[model samples]
Target: MRFSRVVEASGAVAATRSRTRKTAELGGLLDDATAEEIPTVVAWLSGVIPQGRLGVGWRSLTSLTPTPSESPSLTVAGVDDLFVRLAAAGGPGSVALRQGLLTELFGSATESEQDFLRRLMTGELRQGALAGVMVDAIAKASGQPLDLVRRAHMLTGSLPETASLAVHGGAQALAGVGLQVGRAVAPMLATPADSLADAVAALGPDLVVDFKLDGARIQVHRRDDEIAVYTRSLRDITAAVPDLVEVVRGLPCRTVILDGETLTLDADGRPRPFQDTMSRFGSSGELADDPNGLLRPFFFDCLHLDGIDLIDRPLSERLAALTTVAPGMRIPSVTNPTVAEAERHFDAALAAGHEGVMVKSLAGPYAAGRRGKAWQKVKPVHTIDLVVLGAEWGSGRRTGFLSNLHLGARDPDGGPPIMVGKTFKGLTDALLQWQTDEFGRHETHRDGHTVYLRPEIVVEIELDGVQRSSRYPGGVALRFARVVRYRPDKTVDEADTIDAIRALLP
Candidate 1:
């Protein structure tokens, strides 16, 4: 396929404010892709290279190149091999290579497409197309079912792997292999309910209510004495979170993967505001010298213990196993047999300065990367899950780092993510690394220091509140908003809706 096609698609996606329209355009492009060139097509459209978690702009840059470096020397087989190396390389070297690739592609692309590619490569594209749509595009290109692709990619945390499996073995093979591998799904997410009654009505009576801590989501993988800490996006932050590494080192389990949240607390021993924890690291300025702020881990669900994968195990079983292995690291468990008791726990968490509660279904298995009614969140107000559509360039203090994020909520019926507002808070060093690398990839266009992205990543956003807005779409605005963390498991389709925003009216 010509690099022009990919550049054109990027432009189309960016021009499209609606997720459905953007998805359809990309899906059409992928559908036209040849069987032998499916991988290349997917890579170009996603602006990613197969190895590791590739960035968007880097991929776009490479697409324009007449002949970018191919993985002919890769001795290791399968999709995981490429991504693992790429993700591990999380530094300037990998970033520079990607930028070069985009430059090459943009040069080869047509005049119109070049403009689009430039925007995408610079992280300025405001299109609502997200990875969820891209997953659909990948499935269409490979002639696989959407659900099949979603399940496979979600389980492995690598879309390239899913594409390879689809082409090599077909959708059935991907499904079969996924079932045989039997890994846990990512943690389930919640669709905000109008009230507790609505949530209960949606979930019925078989739910298990757990206290939701106002902190960062963490996935801890422990192998014997070796342990790795990953954010919900699957980005490795083991080094930035040395305290978590130390705690996991003492765990009795030989090989294990657990999911939980991390938070920083004030002198009062209360979980600090989500932003306080986020502000501890990831700044280009003098953040390293700040010794007062730190993050602490609070375990929730155990995905693996020793060699056995416990994702299929019930929540009750996983919690029991978690407690037995590391009681001190375990997040406080809320076992309320009644709704009133659960409400009390929610109030108590608020009183303690924590966010709210995460209600889990005791009988459900650990759904590794999917969000469902299995877990529901209840906050006292002032938070929402938003999609990052674009970002403004930083200046002075924020020169290199992202200054502010353009946020949006889910649009029902496959519409565009409605712009709510922008934020520049709730970031740590690890968070900063992830964003810079990620935003760099999504750069559609940049003015001075700002990069724009194709609203593909969904973030858990917290803000003071919403006010009427005439400057942006959706007729509303979010004030003092910032990212809590990136929501890798979620798709733009699953983001908070305008109706949910309307509910925030004071």
Candidate 2:
């Protein structure tokens, strides 16, 4: 198949707001694609490389100003082979070789193909139909059930591979996907509940309320003495923390898959700061400096044990297996707690320096990577009115409009406002139009994607908390921040200060 066909399909998919249309477009493309070309289409549509990140920078991409071909001739295999060469470029004089490949690839692509390839390489493909919509497309093209494809994709953590089996081998191929001991699957996610009462009322008496700790997540796969630990994003950290490898090896079972959170505890057996846990987990060299700061795992759910795959089993059965494996290390959870009892557990978790609590259903099997009613997280978020320092031009569906606001907290020292973070979430088309009109009048300067403003617009923002960071001028950044509303009545002087944000950091 020609690479230009995939580019045209992507544009057609992005030009609509209908999921049915997006799925139909992608399904049609997949129906016409060869088996060898399916994975390339999948990766290019996702704007990611088959081998993961290619380490290509924006400067290098813009430097190769080759004139594009007038007609489309690049095949899917041709592009994939070019990516192979790009990924292989490393060590001494790799710069020129990489640039040569980049120039060659662009020189053969048409003008439209060049734009598509550049955006795809730079990860600017904001087409509304990436992974989620592609999943539906694969199911449509394969004539398979959506749930079956979703399950297979979640289990494998790779849509291209899943699509290949679904397209060529059919349902029996998807059924072959099971919980592998050493392979990492996507972790189940939770939705947000309005309150404890709402969560209890939704999941009912048959629920498990577990302490939601603020730390990095780890999925441990054990096979005798060979153990592997993967992060929530599926990156293997088996070599980073040798202590964790030892802890998993100590488990009684010869083979098991455990899903849990990893945190650093202080000498008093209390959870340490989140920064401390990240420092240990994010390290690529030697372990943490302080021995007491080593990462500790608290098992919560078991997916595989004793040669049995418990992923299709209910949470009740999974928890039972988890208790048999790591009783002492399991997260503190309650079964069918009353409103009063649930509040007490919530208070106890906060008092113990943990986050809030997670309310989960008992009868449902684990829904990997799905944020449905089966699990709901009830974390307390802090809200504050912040000043908008700037806004960036949107892309794809949001093109020609201002999006991704630069948030700032008022400096208590009476200096200029300090930038804390940027967010483009929780925005509507009406809000985007209003922001573009209002902020364009206050434009002070323009730099690439960002347009600086006069720092007069006050907007209310909600966040999980602030984290220690050097990226922002305030020495901290907001985690999971989203715009709540425009504070039209509030002035810049009334906005929350940098000191207030720092106090929220743990």
lDDT of candidate 1 over 1-506, digit per residue (tens):
55455556766776666767777787787666555556655654554454423455344444553433332221112222333443465565877665554454434445655555444344444344456777877776677888888878777766666777887889677777532222333555554545554555555466656667777777887766667776665556666777667777877767777788887777667876665665543423233344445677888877777666677788888888888887887766556346676677777877877767777777878665666667777776656778887777666766666757778787753455778787778767567666877787656576764576666788988777778888877888877777666765445555788878867867
lDDT tens readout by residue for model 2, 1-506: 99899989988877786878888999999989987788778877765678666657867886778888989999888988988889888999998888888989999999989988887786556465556788999998889888888888999988888898888888998888898899999888777687888999999889999999867788999999889998877778888878788888988999999999988899897898655675665578476678887888998899999899999898999999998999998999999899889889988889888878999889889888765688987866656779999999999999999999999998653345889999999788888998998887677689999899876788888888889999987899999999866754345655888988898789
Q: Report the CA-based lDDT of candidate 2 relative to the real structure.
A: 0.84
Q: Against the hidden true structure, what lDDT does model 1 obtain? A: 0.65
RMSD of each: 7.7, 11.5
* CA-RMSD of model 1: 7.7
User: For model 2, how many clashes?
Assistant: 0
- Candidate 2: segments with Cα more than 4 A from true spot: 382-506
TM-score of every prediction relative to native = 0.69, 0.78
Q: Residue 370 of candidate 2: its Cα lDDT?
A: 66
